[model samples]
Structure formats: structure tokens, C-alpha cells
Target: MATTTDPRIAVLSAMAYPPYNETSESRCTPWAEAVKLLADYRAAVLREAADRLDESETLRDLTDDHMHDVNAAANELRRMASEETRPSDG
Candidate 1:
């Protein structure tokens, strides 16, 4: 089973696969590439978070504002990835 922290990467990997008995659209490559990039970035950010917590003397004492900032950054990355993969209504 995939860990919750990395589930998005797993989902993207699964979705990047070719469909059975059907041709894929040309635009799929860009979306797949974007997903892969986001997955890599997410993993890197998580690694950094773990490293920070490990090196900090008082992780338990982190302020709510700092936590919120971290969460917001992660959410922003998700939003950007979603935007890149979404089709525009043009």
C-alpha cells in the first residue's frame, strides 16, 4: 500500500499509463509530464520538512502560523499542478 503522504504521486503514476485497446490523445504527454514534475517536487518538499523537523530542537513548539505557512505552500503546489493539467475553455 502507498503511504498517505505520497498517494498523489502514486495516483499520477497510475493515470499516466496507456489505456487498454484505445489510442491516446496527443495532449496526454504534457499532462503526464506535469504530474511527474509535481510528484517529484512534492517528494522533495516532504523530504525537506522531515529534515527540518529532525534538525529542530523544538519541533513540538512550532507556532500555528508556521504550520499554516507550510500547509499553504503544499496546497499551492497542488493547485498549480491541477491547473497545468486541466484543459482550458478556449
Candidate 2:
């Protein structure tokens, strides 16, 4: 459900098609696909967070607790994404 115009998607697209890279066509295809997959996953996380906020009651008494939970989820997602995309030394 991610739109092409999304800034994250735009950044991914730019990364996938870098200028002056001399890699083979076949190799580039898989890399591009992986970037797209990651972008889609990030979008899904954002959507889920929005949905949870939307479903919460306006007069709920657990605002602080809910905010902490949401912040934790966002931090975890950011950590996971960074770890997954980082290049391995071995």
C-alpha cells in the first residue's frame, strides 16, 4: 500500500539506481528488489502505528503509557532496519 511518491520510497529508488555503478544487470536486479522490499516493510510499520493511534479512545487515561509504547515500537523498528541493512564484515 505504499505510494511511489512517498519520500522513503523515493530515497530507496534513488539508492537502488545509483549513477556510475558498473555492476552486472542480473546482480543489480536483486539489489533493487531488496531495497523495494525493505521500503515496503517500513511503510507497513508506519501504517500499523497510525492504525493503533486511530483506534485509541480520545479520552483514554493511559496517554503517557501509550506514548511510551509507541515510541518503543518506533525505536525497535529503526534498530531492526538499520541492523538488517548494515553490511557484514564477514
List, residue by residue over 1-90, the lDDT tens digit for candidate 2.
Answer: 233755466556656664443565332435565565565566566655655654566524567888777667656665665565555443
Best by lDDT: 2
Looking at model 2, residue 57 earns an lDDT score of 69
Each prediction's TM-score versus the true structure? 0.34, 0.36
**Span of 10 residues, lowest total lDDT, candidate 2:** 20-29
Model 2's alpha-carbon lDDT is 0.57
The residue-level lDDT of candidate 1 at 3 comes to 30
Backbone Cα, N, C clashes tallied per candidate: 0, 0
lDDT string, candidate 1, 1-88, tens digits: 1233464665555456523433553334345544555655555556555556545666546788986665566566556555544554
**Candidate 1 wrong stretches, greater than 4 Å:** 1-29, 60-90
Q: Count backbone overlaps in model 2.
A: 0
Candidate 1, TM-score vs. the true structure?
0.34
